[model samples]
Target: MTATCLLPLFETSYVAGEGPDRFYAWPDALILPQKVRGFYVGFLTYTYHKGGFYLLEGWFSWFIVIWTVILLGLMSIGGYFMFRKFLKRLPKEDGMSILDWEEHYINETRHLWDEEQKQLLDELVSPVPELFRDVAKSKIAGKIGELALEEKASKITEDLIIKGYIVATPKRDHKFLIKKLNEKQIDYSRYQSLLAK
Candidate 1:
């Protein structure tokens, strides 16, 4: 013997003078659940009511019941197969799970690494040997992190230098000018005449 359950997906009720006047005149249908021969059955009760009193009540025609059963069965089967397929597509433990790596590493440093940098690091570390991949990836990520920090530091330094020059601070301005001249390979002799003035 098998036990079945009745689950109501939708239902609505209206008391006399509590609902819209249109609902009172409209024919109402009640879908009730029944257990028969170990299977749950849906019985539709069509009722005609006037002034909050039922004038007539009868079961739905056989054609409607047959069609409803067919549709429900198809929907149930389709939902079951879809759920199975979704389960099969989930990440499995075979040692090549990106989700595992992401959960372990990326989730922690998400704020530090942007999508582009992460993609670049992945591209750089992908061709490495499997034994060294994790180490290589970590090294690459660390290097990228250091580079970003250095870039921000240099920008701050440059801004400070510019502000110093704007304020006519001789020491900082002279140091930056000298650095620029050295980078351009310009001889100090070229600026000696201006300095002499």
Candidate 2:
């Protein structure tokens, strides 16, 4: 996210009150997060009790104002530096720059590689079941499409459905089936024979 967006996430203010009549105020010095929009915005507010002016009649009144100012100044300075540091620490998001795109691409590629490896490993260790083989054979019959020798397509597809990849429908269309297959990143023809069954 941009510093502009992060600015408002750190916004804060203060209020003081004793009863139905209350007071609110904000710092005199405003600190803002950096932005490429060429503008900075900060907010403040002041509220006074309906009839509490007498509360400020003593020497403590000046002390309260001075203390508030000093506290706000320190907070402003601290906020500026802290936000600058936070921005530096933020992980980059997509679309802002080429580096972001490259990072995303690399991560996607690695994930795909890992998935393929897992699939291969699973295939090597487990034998295809007989029901799946029969289903695969039936599915390939009329279309003249030859099924892969893996012969476990039905079981695999069933497992995928169980895992939430595929959904059952009362009516099926070839195009919609293909679209769902694509969304799952499965090879289009991989299940063609199996599906016929």
Candidate 3:
């Protein structure tokens, strides 16, 4: 409601011998009386200063405000340490995150991919924007290189590049991947098994 419609309520805030007398006479509508009572308790309980200003000049108010800040700082520091400890406990291959291993694998197999595989990787990642295309190609190559190292294969193949492209793409972006696959006239049905993974 506009301020004019609410003028009646705002004009009724009268202090009696003990407390606000206006809140006691609100219409007994469903839950409205309780809401008005809550509003009165929230505003009237705080003693206001004169000059129509809302400056809270008191020691107790300052103490509570400072204490809340101190507690928030303590909680944030504690939570950070707790998260670090938790991350340290998860099992890792070579004691590194996935991104680090991807880089390592990419370097290890950098010499193994023939020119054909390199061209295929470039084509597969072309759908990505120019800004992120290099990063996307590196990640896809790393994934394909990782599988080669796992199987101890001597070189990368068309199948490995295609599978890695699909696997590296997030599920949310699979539609774009499918569109790219269709544009290239590659049969995506053959990769349904990898997509299911």
Candidate 4:
């Protein structure tokens, strides 16, 4: 596992953040090293001359190593900026990422949803914007499914779905949820217990 600790150090030394290289290299770097020894990179070859590592293999290998390093550095640094530019960091709930929590319930109880509940779910998420409609529907459905499992209910129901939607939504988005509920003529008074929270 010496390569495990050393490869990324050598690769990322020229980069700022953990680049795609980290993800891309692990399958080979960490896994192969367990089956082989010594520093074995594709382009970055090393020699034990004078008891020090040097890029003195040849002009071509030297250029390849330099090119690879520069590319890795740019990608590692760019990945962070790209993350800021593209991805939205969802707030964690109960000390877990929202996406993680979403997968948990969906994996556990997705079969609990019947065709009627699925139809109702489509209607409920109808008012959501097209871009986020899928996420909203999945979140609401995941929560509903989670509640059904928690309460040991045999099947999902309208009340369970409504309650799950409220609990799954953040307080800031409640206005939209409330507005949609009003448009759909769903009563919030019955969910007064959840609303008060």
Number of backbone collisions per candidate, in order?
A: 0, 1, 0, 0
Best model number under lDDT = 4
Which digits, one per residue and each the tens of the lDDT, describe model 1 over residues 88-189?
446767753433543444334446654654554454345457866775455434333333354554222223222222232233334544565466464555
Per residue, candidate 4 scores C-alpha lDDT tens digits across 95-185 of 6665667778887887777899888778777768897789788888778878988899878888898888889887676677678678878
Give the clash total for candidate 1: 0
lDDT of 2 at 188: 52
Q: Candidate 2: where are CA atoms >4 Å away?
A: 1-55, 93-197
lDDT of each: 0.44, 0.36, 0.64, 0.65
Q: Over the stretch 1-197, how does candidate 3's per-residue lDDT look in tens digits?
A: 11111111233333322333222222321111115544631221122233121223357545655666698899999899678756645548768766677788999998888998788778767778997788688778888988888889888987788878878878766777778778878788988887877
Instruction: Report how far off residue 136 is in candidate 4 (Å).
Output: 1.4
Q: Candidate 2: lDDT of 193?
A: 49
Q: Weakest 10 consecutive residues, lDDT, candidate 4? A: 1-10
RMSD, one per candidate, in order:
22.8, 21.1, 11.9, 14.9
Residue 56 alpha-carbon offset, candidate 1, angstroms: 8.1
lDDT of 2 by residue, 34-151 (tens): 3438753332222233422212223554455566679899999989967765664455663234334334433333322245533532332223256353322222221111111123
The alpha-carbon deviation from the true structure for residue 18 of candidate 2, after best TM-score superposition, in angstroms, is 24
Error of 4 at 89 (Å): 8.6
Give the higher-lDDT candidate: 3 or 4: 4
**In candidate 3, residue 36 scores what lDDT?**
53
